[model samples]
Target: MKQGLGTQLRHLIELLDGAVQQSYADAGLDYRPRYTPVMRALAGGQPHSVSQIAESAGISQPAATQTVALMLKEGWLVAQPGPTDARQKLLRLSAQGERLLPQLQACWRATSAAANSLDADLPYPLSETLAHAIAALEQRSFSQRIRDAKE
Candidate 1:
């Protein structure tokens, strides 16, 4: 019995994330792979709202909010009242996050190199495949497929 596409995709993500998390640990950094996007978005030293972070990081607002919460708990992020919109909280990296930037950048470079190598080993590069799949989904979403199937 073969696994479903979703199961295989999820398993692959878990494997890759686990490997990267272990690498971060080995480098004495207590960082999660999922935090990378938010960190990168804040690395520019400009304060951004959760919505901005989500767009810049190509993630969902809920995911960005969750990551922001986790980062705040870890002291990696700080939120200040938005200059123009007092109601909106603008998020930025804390001093600790700034200090960790160098180490994080090093890890990012190594991880990118490793991913490139992995891609070279594969017949079709994972990145390109994922991009194409995303594009295809955008053209015809899974929800539409289910709706079509029901009829």
Candidate 2:
């Protein structure tokens, strides 16, 4: 049986994420690839709320919240009460997280180089394809396409 587009996309993600995760392990870094965006968002040394992290990371708020929780548990991040809203928490990198930044940045560079090489091997660059797809989706969502097909 042939796999659908969603299945294929998921398989691709598994392959990519697995390789990156392995690289992090090989580098003796106790980090998840999922944590990269959040780390980058907080790299400036300014504390930010979950909503700010989500916006800075270009991810959903729920994703930011979940990642922040994981990071806090791992001792990679610390949270303090928001200045005005006690219910809101501002997050920043812990000392351990700060110490890990250089290594993480190096890994990121290596990953980018690997990605560039992979893109060169492909006829259509995956980054460009993803950007194009996102742009199209912004104009007309997959749900709209499905409705049109149904009609």
Candidate 3:
């Protein structure tokens, strides 16, 4: 069946999300599939404020605050006074969380490989092109959401 582009992209998204979420679970990490995007945004080893996390996570500020509070309680993150703004709090992974990063990264690699293996017969370039196209669409969706909220 020749699925529509949106349907194909949705399937790809579901597959990737499942793989990543399962990888984290298999590795005994605190897995929040929705938070994966947030993790990626903060993966550069830079401290980000809670509002930054919310923006990057595509979530509400209250939601991000709740999640960050949970992560903090779990000893995965620590909060400190922001360098530029004393009123703002900087959030960074704790030493334990930092140590777990390598394992999580390995899981990501393994999961990605498994996803590729699912369609080994397809040319890799085709998949890469599809991914780029879908990413563009997602960006547009995000923009539209922001625009709608302004009305």
* Model 2 ranges off by over 4 Å: none
Residue-by-residue lDDT tens digits, candidate 1, 58-143: 99999999999999999999999988889999999999999999999999999999999999999999989989999999999989
| Candidate 2 pairs with clashing backbones | none
- Once model 2 is optimally superposed onto the true structure by TM-score, how far is the C-alpha of residue 119 displaced, in angstroms? 0.8
Off-target runs (Cα >4 Å) in candidate 3 are 1-12, 50-70, 118-120, 123-151
Question: What is candidate 2's lDDT per residue for 1-151, written digit by digit as tens?
Answer: 9999899999999999999999999999999999999999999999999999999999999998899999999999999999999888999999999999999999999999999999999999999999999999999999999999999
TM-scores, all candidates, are 0.97, 0.97, 0.58
Model 1 TM-score (2 dp): 0.97
List the lowest-lDDT window of 10 residues for candidate 3.
32-41
The lDDT of model 1 is 0.96
lDDT tens digits, residues 49-69, model 3? 998988977788998888888
Each model's backbone clash number? 0, 0, 0
lDDT for position 105 in model 1? 98
